[model samples]
Target: MDQVVSEKVARDPTADYIAAIEEHGYVRIPQVFDKSTVDTMLDRVSAWFDKTVQAQSARMPRLNKQQPMVYNLQSKDIAFCRLILQTPVIEDILKHFLNDQWFSSVPAEDPNYILRSFLARSSNYQMPMHIDSFIPYTGSYPFIMQCSIPLEDQTRENGCTVIVPGSHKSNKYAEQSAIEQAIPIESKAGDLIIWDSRIWHAALDNVSGRTRWSIIATFCRWWIKQAFDIPGNMPQKIYDQLSNKEKAVLGFCSVPYDDETRGIDMKRSYDLLPEKVADYRI
Candidate 1:
């Protein structure tokens, strides 16, 4: 049965990913890209980092050589945009999580998911155990999810992410006991690991002496405030090149408030509503 299932997933990655995430609150999908693709991305990241350092050095004469990270890669490079927006498996999983209209105010536009943040972490960077849903919201559905793509091999020695399975179902924050039960997710280059934002997770210390390269792309419901102003900050040329769906995902269509003056307007119907409008009223 296991062999049969593995073979099935090799043919259809989306179905397997959905099942695995539903069961474990996270899933590791292997070989999403070939080695050559991974190598190209890594090279781009390295070049970006070098440019950033040169630019920053003029302002601060002595910058500490700590773990360096580049944020908002969608705006910085087209490769990241393709990886985050063009990947079919990623799009399918995001649709499953964000396309539901039950929790959205404007059902027509609310189901869209937007990129929250995209960053590449390198060197000895160890993150503290915590859940990504730090903001308070009145919804049972997951508000955010994150996809981690390693540009290099992630091993126990190089600080792979450690996670507590099924922790997303727990309504409470992670306690010391939950942290102790965390297990490392060792993966190879080009592998993609995704998890519910509410899951308790952390990265281990890198003792391998080699820089661990990984890209983290976080997505959230369209209504949630993005980490960066993607639509506003993105290069005009790149923004112009995006499709309608990509524009929606980058929050180009999400309005802050609907025009109540427009009579009999279904588009702005939910805009004039109060907080927790989805809740049943007495």
Candidate 2:
């Protein structure tokens, strides 16, 4: 993947991303992460899935054994996820949406952003139409955005994400015509899809026999609620292991609704923090 991105970067491939999002509310950045890194994550994820299946089996009787399933990203191989969250490319993308404010994975009072992984191991899972905005947010407070990166190539044959172009500003989802206007986004591994959360989107059916895997990290303004409660689920020990910059991104300093000025100041929200803290004893 690195070679792919390095070549794309040399040719300035990101130029289209900004322009596409500005015009159509979405854009695709090909080969965002290096291939080796992506392959490592895939292997790690598979191992994690197998481990979970074994653990679950131990808790149930042999007669009750069921087909193996891959859980969402938040629960499996957390360490690998942490590495992905802190990648520089992802952070650069976040800066466009979040500005200089502290961003975290933990949900605030009105959660604005969430970083989640989705794996379609079964053929039946389908996400419904919904916007990233807080449904109750009546006016223009949303300005929400979502980023989807595929761990595997996203082909129409394998259920790529389908969206309605420019639907983020419309009220058409209630109409039958809206369903007919959807467009599928197809790409290869390491491709990044950034879109307006307000756009009507649904996961396409995976008619192919293989599983589909993707990771999405959503970024929104500080005023909205996240889909998941980040801080509540993250253990204290895990939180302690993170650098202050990561903690800020995970919403540890304050709930999402707290005053913006009260949040931790992250010098590197998209990159790894310095190896040593000012008060470090190590």
The predictions' CA RMSDs to the true structure, in order, are 7.7, 8.2
Query: TM-score for model 1?
Result: 0.80
Put down candidate 1 lDDT per residue, 1-282, tens digits, no spaces: 011124253667677777767666788877787898899999999888887755544332122246667767988887788887888878888888766564443455433677888888875866777888884233447779999899999887998888888777777776656657898888889988888888888878889888888989999876788987675677766765666566567665453433444333222223343232221010
* lDDT by candidate, in order shown: 0.72, 0.54
Query: Least accurate stretch of 10 residues (summed lDDT) in model 1?
Result: 273-282
- Clash number for each model: 0, 19
Give the clash count for model 1: 0
For residue 46, model 1's alpha carbon misses the true position, in angstroms, by 0.9
lDDT of 2 by residue, 1-282 (tens): 111223344455454455455556677777777798768766776676677665553554332234234544544445644654566655655555554334343322222233432332322344455565544232333356776667788767776767777666674342334556777777777777787666777656667777666656666554445445655565545555665545445543333323355444422232332233321211
Model 1 lDDT at residue 204: 81
Worst 10 residues of 2 by lDDT: 273-282
